[model samples]
Target: MRQQQPAPQAATGTTAGLANAGSKKARPSVWKEYVKTRYLFLLLAPVLIWYAIFAYGPIYGIQLAFKQYQIMDGISGSPWVGFDNFKYLFEASPDFWKVLSNTLRLSLYHIVFGFPAPIILALLFNEIRFNAFKRITQTLTYLPHFLSWVVLSGILFIILSPSTGVVNFLMQKVGIEPIYFLGNGHYFRFTLVVSSIWKEVGWGTIIYLAALASIDPQQYEAAIMDGASRWKQTLHITLPGLLPAIAIMFILRIGGILDAGFDQVLNLYTPGVYSVADIIDTYVYRMGLTQMQFSLTTAVGLFKNVIAFALVLMTNFFVKRAGQEGLL
Candidate 1:
């Protein structure tokens, strides 16, 4: 047997070949696997179709940004203009700059004040040991979120009206002049910020409250044993526990910095506050639908979206670099 034994290299090669052949035979084809999971694909089909139709479908219309967009010619037949619309936005339109500035300022106000409102509310809610009072307070807060912005705007108009509003009546009784909250450009941004926070704070707080509930109770007990006050525990433990959720939310907010609440602004704003309240979305609405400047409107929208997308990417990168999970 020794005299006629195969070489060690040959024997090893044979064994390896046989093993690879066995693996090849054992592995299922992609078609077979797809067939096996056909039911799951069927269940997911509607969502995929919906996104394909509504979400991704609109991406094809981005051509309108770079084209003259003759309605009679349609998207594909429109003549190429090669950045003329963008040039008009950057150079020709004075209103564009004002609109951009207003959008940025409004969004910044929301970030600075409105962003933290929910966190504060959630923390305050957490400290409330009375379950009934907590539930009622939470319900009262979140109920405004379910109301349409139209209804909320109508309520706000009555409440913030300089002459007949309950707020103005109170001010008059206190010997103070009634302020035009919604009408004056000087106060319009402030009104927008305050109204927005009031409308959405409760719904936003629900996320943070859920995050708070997920923190280990044992950590709090240990902190209490170590003579930690509620504030100390919150600063050291609770804040750290909520950091991931906060970072994710912050990144999302940064991504939408240009949006500035289109529906709310449209419903609440008048020509008196146009200088302070005319955001990109409202401008887009006017140009596209009212003025029929379809190409220019498309260019502006594309610009806003590109900037927002970049902001999201940069924010997410910094968040992860700082050792917190972000919305990727």
Candidate 2:
């Protein structure tokens, strides 16, 4: 070192240059690593394209909510009316209150009675010892879900027909008057909820069944060894395990509180039950297609979507705060 140290400056410069050169080389390799995932991206390309074309593409039409849409001008060229559509829906339409009330009542009834039915069915199915019987019952119940609302409505119409219906025949044997299930305003919402529950309960039970399947068998054995009753085990282990699934489903249901089964209602309802059966979706459909009020329909749809988005967010917030699995 005393004789001929090449020069401390040269040594430091070489180290610095090598470090810089290494980083420069590393950057391209990192980029190449990213580019190598092109096949994975190609797999997702169709879904991305679908959303762009169908989901996000249609969102551009939302601007019609603020405009007075004309056939000649179309969406972009239509004259801006500045909330006139919303004003009309809120102030001018008397059907607004009736339809909204019907929608809320139907949804509330479904939540109260319909929501728990699948859980109950799932629990009951879990207790069945005969595998073949269980499979047959499940198949029969789920078959109705595959039927279109139009077909189901037609079937219901015949079954509930006062003149020759099986239901009326049974009622007559019991000395009770034949009730007009489809024609009466008072029974429309009730029938709708019942029919919906009957059609959907089986399909809904699939999720709960999956959740039940995931429960550790060892826990049940331990509970049995501890002298825990069947009901006690269900209440403690089964129900608690199912709670996360239930919470997630509940949040999804709340998100679509305004839905109220539009296709079923539209197919089953007549003018006689319009006051109690007409929901937001059916009303929007009537306004848009039948009445040709495109702007009002768009505004109503936008309002419904916004409300749904907010409801989902709020429900998810509460779920997370309560230490449950959330949609996020």
Candidate 3:
């Protein structure tokens, strides 16, 4: 009797129709998305394949860390030794602490000296009004970044050679003795840090420059209207704008605290400087490959990864608590 209660069948039909409509809304258009972005998917196929082959594929072998790996027995057939490998790492390994200390010190040196370099370069470059000159300077700085560590190490050797190198030649002109930078343990760490900065600072600046580009021009103009100088504007506006990017990069750098520039260190290091030069990666290489202590080295690697992961989490937590955005 009320508003058209009609037949029970009619009401059921209306309810069914509403249910169908609700069902349609709830259903995801996953297939439709694939069809619409099929070209983009095709473009991404190679990268997916690359990760599958080179990155994710090796995860299966991580079990080797817990097992006594035998070449004849293979990874799967290797007998599990449980925590023995890890025990060896902590209790028995002679140079474990030394290597760990070297790794941390090198990483700290890179972060302390290397991290701010690109930011400084970016700031200086941003102030340059001449586009052509800025581009030339940027290009010159960036060229070294593209060079391989092998090539760069060779270049360093040639330049720092005590007898024939130009650096030593200049030292002689200044009435100073030619110093073997790469060979002498006293200067090896210093050389490593400085060379690393030279090779990487230019490339690292690209991120900061990109961050700088997105900063609002109006902020600078407003600052100018308020009698702010360029220095004041940069200090107040530019750095604040760049803080998010800096925080993110810093978090990432902390995640790699154990890495310590493997390629650069490996290429530049010699037996003479191994005490100071040997990092986690080189130590693992020597133990695992050179000495055939696979299980021991794998345990060391696992320990490093755990610490790095913890550092990343801790860093992100502090960064977020400080009222800045973090990588998490």
TM-score on alpha carbons, each prediction: 0.90, 0.89, 0.91
- By lDDT, the best candidate is 1
TM-score head-to-head 1 vs 3, winner: 3
Ranking by lDDT: 1, 2, 3
Give the winner by TM-score. 3
For candidate 3, lDDT tens digit of each residue in 202-245? 99999999999999999998999999999899899999989999
State model 2's lDDT: 0.93
Task: For residues 160-245, write the lDDT of model 1, one tens digit per residue.
Answer: 89999999999999999999999998989998899889989999998899999999999999999999999999999999999999
Q: Candidate 1 — worst ten consecutive residues by lDDT sum?
A: 1-10
lDDT of 2 by residue, 1-328 (tens): 5687688899999999999999887766755776898898899999999999999999999999999999898888999999988998899998887888888888999999999999999999998989999999999989999999999999999999988999999999999999999999878888898999999999999999999999999999999999999899999999999999999999999999999999999999998988888899999999899999999899989989999999999999999999999999
Model 3 poorest 10 in a row by lDDT: 1-10
Superposed Cα RMSD, model 3: 3.9
Q: Give the TM-score of candidate 2.
A: 0.89
